[model samples]
Target chain A: MSHRLRILSRIRKALDAPAMPSETARAEAVAERIAHPPQHWPLRSIQTADPEGAAQLTLIGRFKAQLARLGADVIEVGSVAEIPAALANYVAANVADDAAGLARIRMGSDAFLAALPWSSTSGLEIAAGMAEAADVIGVSRAIAGVAETGTLLLVSGAENPVTLGYLPETHIVVLETGAIVASYEEAMQSMLAATGGRMPRTVNLITGASRTGDIGGKIVMGAHGPRRVAVVLWSA
Target chain B: MTARTQFDADIDTALADAPLQRALADVPAGFVAGRRRAREELLEFEPLRRVARDIRDHALAHLDLYLEAFESNATKAGSRVHWAASGDDACRIVLDICRAAGARTITKSKSMVSEEIELRERLQDAEFDVVETDLGEYLVQIRNEKPSHIIAPAIHMRAEDVADVFRRQHGHLAPDRKLDTPEEMIAEARGILRDKFLSADVGITGANFLVAESGSAIIVTNEGNADLTMSLPKVHVILTSIDKVVPTFSDAWPLLRLLARSATGQAFTAYTTIVTGPRRPDDPDGPEQCHIILLDNGRTELLASEMRPVLRCIRCGACMNHCPVYCSIGGHAYNSVYPGPIGAALSPALAGAEQAAHLAEASTFCGRCEQVCPVEIPLVSVMRQWRSLALEQPRSRRARVMLHTWARLAQHPRIYRWCAGIAARSLKWLAGSGARIRRLPFLHAWTDYRDLAAPQGGTFQQQWAQREHKRAQRDRADVSAARARKSDSVP
Candidate 1:
């Protein structure tokens, strides 16, 4: 017998309580388990009213605060048209007066990046691809954002290259306001709904800038990923 | 990767290492404070832990079924699933995959299973250039040392130690570069590893959880190196055990909720990546070949035995973080890939009782590990079980003889009290006014570290009996005085 068969048989014999199920039976049981989700999750709604009443503003405020708390900066804009100006403002304020004068960035030219008017930002070196080691900043789009933990969920694809998320000293992400969810469950539900139950090749849920405490138990940012994560939030 | 059956000697060495002790001292303040703060923010923290525990239990109860479902779906999602019955088999399988891919250089994230199978050494023996991408793992790798803790591999070392290692290993770097802080050191490592990531033929990461429902393997890390490792390489391999499989995402979130809070006290890790399969046909940025290697290295026996509560471990390192023995001696003392309470309980089962029984005896039975465990595993009880099993084997004749004598003395109350009373009186005589025993036969190990307080008076039973007699006399006097007062009132 193969190693797989041998190991499985040994485990079954050791268990010795019931006969091993067939593949069909196993699939059914799995379906049953998935259909009946486990309980005791703290993510349920406590108040029984419009979840979007005053809580929408509360969630937006919480999301920005939590994101800032986790070493991320948020720039809330009124619409997608204002995103380019917000991006320019963030760059001019934070990265314009660098040791090299202006900031250099590798922006993933996804649908989101393509939508932004390029002529707006002057004196910025922005290329379209995965980030290289020499790149000081990376820009990408977040598929979704979680308000509970201030996390941005990005899907890996031809447009939103996965490397653009982590391969920079500073990472700036474009997030649409409508995609923000109050809890991980709601975020997951919306994501599944959008994808039609197809999980992306890679789903990166980034909560904050990269950090490490391995040396002398000190919290230091910019370990391997971006040292700074700034979100350009688009208001619906 | 050498397995030391002499756990006592290793622990002795660790206890003597002043640097290790000092490094361990910082653990309580760092880990405990973070967890407390993270938990305080969440109203559902305790409820999440219960759900996580139940999810693990339910999954393990039907482990065989879940494994099959995971394999089927993962295969459909364009990933090969390999099974290994033992550590040797696991290594051979990984080597075969590397050879098939013509991998000359491979980068790896933090994987305890890779440590368990000694994969780096095996690959090196095959002349593969293996690089550890995680900062902690890379530091340990450069120093030619094993990980001290599972998560925080270089927690035992100071920043000076890292600087020295970098200077020694990366001889090509500018000699005068000031590497005083972790940031400078991290920057240096990142610059060096960036080239390796671009060049590595394969990347291997450990799985935190495997979702059977989605055919995805989840990896949780603060550093984005795992992402870069998998995203940059041509082939990505997940080296994990069978127990990581959960029924679905519904089951996984609870464990994820408790894991980060229990670990470093983050609401969520900076990055929690869930990789479903190999890169999609249209996907721009993932490995073309993604493989999952499931190793059953003595875990099948654990699943079958009464000691199965241990399989519920999420590898959060909370148990070891709060373990007094671990904090005192550090992870190197355990002499296994796993260290702390979980290690003490599971190693004897994994490595064998004869070779690993000393680890089970290393605990103080304080149950701090159990108290903080996300799954609420009975860690003290498991350690006790291992100790009992060791006791039955009678490995050391002197230990067995002493235990047998104590058992005999403990079984008889009259003889025990009589002997205890004499011993107490003699100890009191020895102690005098100081109230401490400076020396005692067969207990130098205890007295060596700290003084044993002398018995101030007679045996506990004798003292209780005397107190009871005084109470009876006082009660009778009170009753008689009450009767006298009543007769006077009547006259």
Candidate 2:
């Protein structure tokens, strides 16, 4: 094993209070729990011929419809191949009305946008070169369709950065049917097993809109995250 | 800020607070009963706890790999990742992102980390119109106050108090609205926040968990506001501590079970949404941009210490509900956003022991917090660690000396016995005619409220020793007589 992985293994062992089963039984137990589980929304799993293609199409269709319902303009990109060109065009279109927005477009053009804000723009920079771009960014996680709770689990340092989840006003998550589990316990067990017993540092189990009942018990949605949520479902 | 902590002369002050005392009286019964019922109802609760604890421990131990994986995935998904080493850095990252976005109005969900960082004051200092959308947060925000509790931020305020605030602030819409019921109050607040949600240029939230497997920052709220916050704004920024990450969506189950049940006795909250990166191709009304700030304010340092187990806390609020001190003094007494057992340990560590020296001493060393913590954080031991630190100051020297003197006196049984006898005699004399004293100097605090009855003349050890001695004497006499009779028979 690699040194880092070995150290991780040692730590995992130290933290574990011997689960009553041997390794084989442990795996079997996990599989059993996954098969039949506790009270939660009904989960539907899908096996697709092309997972990426299916995910993209579902997300695009769902987001457009949801945004249209909320009375917002929509932009469509078929693939990562089209991101740069699309982003530039998108920036130019909104430039006249939003000067700061234009600067963001200019800033985002750095080799690495991380340094664009403070002007040390160097290393691993991906410039947005006159391509059609998006003002709002939405990322989809492997989604779960299990309960009335309509929850999603966003782990920090995963396919979507924590920033993308919260920085955008209108965030769209594309959820796969297979990601939904029967209960919270099932979710954790699956996560633990998948990462070879190492859990992610942060797991965001988001259910419903970003809201605050803070102002005198008022229920206001969109307090801090995307004010609207559109969940894209792939057929099982 | 108003209530004194355990180390302050405020121990007595907090004990004397009648309103706080009344509010706290229900904690032991309410939390204890609810927990007992919850456990009884769910047979798998213990297993669930074990699973959750294990999962969190595993994640924290191998945090780097998962964090790397999450960051890579997020970038590929088109979301920008900003790594913050401290609370200040985290806040700065968010502010910079918004400044770049030219965001004028920012709406927020209730985020405890933001509270830890004092994010609101900092953001307001920067001139952004930050509005708290959570009802509890809004109430406290309107009052220019800090949250009194974690789950119920404005837990200290009564319904009528909320009504009064609404009447003053939301007068335009609800001029004649009477906040008689929780439902009515909720309705009024709803009307006011809807407008703000629509107009917000940016939305910031704290994630309960950040899934590394898929690079998502997830939020769970009873009200659907978190969903809207995650979905509506053009810009979405998640401010979260690095510890919030888990490996994958599948691993979120066990902890989620514990979180909802422990927080408010629900099987599950109303909403749980997973957000990955910014909107992909063909997407409609999602944020055009998304940013995830992975904050590491003092956490990486904490990971190297004995204090690391504290990171496993899921923020379930079980410890708070069961804490006696918290019940009596409430959250404001701790003087930090986090209150109760967790706060007692966390505040001192997060904001320097000097700033929160009194917090650790506030405990009666009650084990209820540990007993109920879903994550099983050894809170009492952590509090003791803080106490050890607090004891290093000169002010604690007197207490240390007194304790040492008592320890020395307690070593010799004879001295202990003599002291006990003297104490018993003095108390008996003071209680002449079998009446308890109404008060005593230096002990008036205890005696004024309730009398300490006089003990029996002899101590338990003394009585037992006398009985043993008399039995030995009787045995000797009997043996001698029996030996004499045997001698006579032989002759």
Candidate 3:
């Protein structure tokens, strides 16, 4: 027998000792659980019963608060058009001046980011591709924001490559205000709905900039990833 | 020396190591205290823990079905799924994949399963330049030492020790560079590892959870190295066990919620990546090929055994953080890939009772591990089961004899009380005025470290009997007085 068969048979034998349901019954039970997952666990911080707009607002508020606590910067812009200026201001303030004196922003070919008016902002060099080693700042668009944990859900594809999130010292995530959700469960459901039940190649639920406490138990941010994660939350 | 004696010597050596002692002191203040704060902040932590346990149990109960589901879904998603019955088999499979990819350089994130299989040494022996990307794991790699702690691999080393190691290994750099703080060390390691990430041909990691629903492999990390590992290389391989599979994304959320909180007191880790398959055809960047190696490594047998709850461990390290034995001796002394309460129960189950019985006997049954476990695994009970299995061995003749004598005496209450009273009286007499015994005959192990407090002149049974008699007398007097008061009221 093959290793897979042998292993499965071993598991069956082990589980056979107990008086369990039939094999068909077990398969049915698994299928049932997967088809209809349980409701979201009640999180005290976010009220699930609020109106849609209010709930989104609550999620955005909670999301910002959680991110702030983790040392992330959240910048809210009035509209998509203001993002370039916001990004430019953030870069000027946080990122150290390089020898070029121009901020280089590397990003994937995401439609949402590409549609933005970036040429209006001066001293900003924009490149549409995967991040490189010398890239100082990388920007990507998040599909959804999780409120309870302040997480960003980024799917990997040609539109938003996974490398852009980890390679740069400064990571700028573009999250629309309407895309913020109350919990991971809702975000997952939305993702499934968007993909027609087929999962994307990669789904990254990023909470903050990369950090490590392995050295003397002291937390040092930007360990092998972005040191700073700046979320530009824009509303229409 | 016998295994028992050698373990004792290890304990003594660990206790005497001053640097280790200093490092161990941080466990309570770091992981333990952090978990407490995280748990306190979440109002639904207790209920969520129960949900997490149930999810794990349900998956394990029908593991065969879930494994099949995961295999089918993953294969459909363009990922090649491989099965290995043991660690050696898993290592060979990984090497074959690397060889097929013509991988000259391999970068790995922190994967305890990979460590369990000793995969790095195997790969390096085949001349693959393997690099550990996690900061803690990188430090341990440079020192040529096994990780002393699961979450914090270099927990045994001080900042200065790390600096010395870096200085010695990175000799091409200036010798007198100031690497004093963790910040400096982190920056230096990051710069060095960034090049490895960009240059590696294959990246390897371990999955915390495998979603049977979508055929996704999820890895949780505070550092972004695992992301870079899976993203940069042309080939990505995930080394994980069969027990990591969950039914759906919903099932994964609860476990994810408990993991970071229990491990480091964070609401969420910095990165939780779920990879369904290889990169899409149009993707700008990601591993072109993805492989999932499902390793059994004696886990199926473990599932059949009475110690099945040991499989519920999520590798949070909370059990170890709260374990008294672990806090004292540290992870190295356990001499197992996993260490502490979970290790005590799991090592015996995986390696067999006779070979690793000393690990089971190393616990004080303080119950802190179970108390802090996110899955609520009965760790103490599992360790006790291992102890029972150990007693049947021929080498446990002395222990069996002592237990047999105690059991016989325990069956008869009068004889047990009489012998216990005499023993307590003698101990009290030996203790003199201080009521502390500085030395004990045939039990120097207990007295060698600290003075054992003498029993207060009698056994527990004698003291309980006396208290019961006095309580009965007091109760009768109170009833009679209540009756007298009622008669006076009637007159």
Candidate maximizing DockQ: 3
Scored against the true structure, residue B70 in model 2 reaches a CA lDDT of 77
- Candidate 1: which pairs clash? none
Each model's lDDT:
0.83, 0.63, 0.89
Candidate 3 structure quality by residue, lDDT tens digits, B1-491: 66666777888999889999999999899888899888877768888899899989999999999999999999999999999999999999999999999999999999999998899999999999999999999999999989987888889888889989999999888988889899998999998999999999999999999999889999999998999999999999999999999998888888998999999999899999999999888888888899999999889988998878788889999999998889989988887888888888887666666667778898989899999899999998998988887777775667778989999998999898889888998889889897799999888878876799999846897788899999999999999999999999995
Summing lDDT over every window of 10 consecutive residues in candidate 2 chain A, give the lowest-scoring window: A40-49
Write down the C-alpha DockQ for each prediction. Answer: 0.51, 0.07, 0.61
Please give, for every candidate in the order listed, the TM-score of chain B alone compared with the true chain B: 0.91, 0.86, 0.95
Per-residue lDDT tens digits for candidate 2, residues A157-199, read 4234444445344444544455665444555556556557543
For model 2, what fraction of the real interface contacts is kept? 0.12
Lowest-sum lDDT 10-residue window in model 2 chain B? B1-10
- In model 3, the fraction of reference contacts reproduced equals 0.84
User: TM-score of the candidate numbered 2?
Assistant: 0.66
DockQ, candidate 3, vs. native dimer: 0.61
Q: Candidate 1: where is the Cα deviation over 4 Å?
A: A18-28, A45-57, A96-102, B1-5, B426-442, B453-491
lDDT value, residue A154 of candidate 3: 90
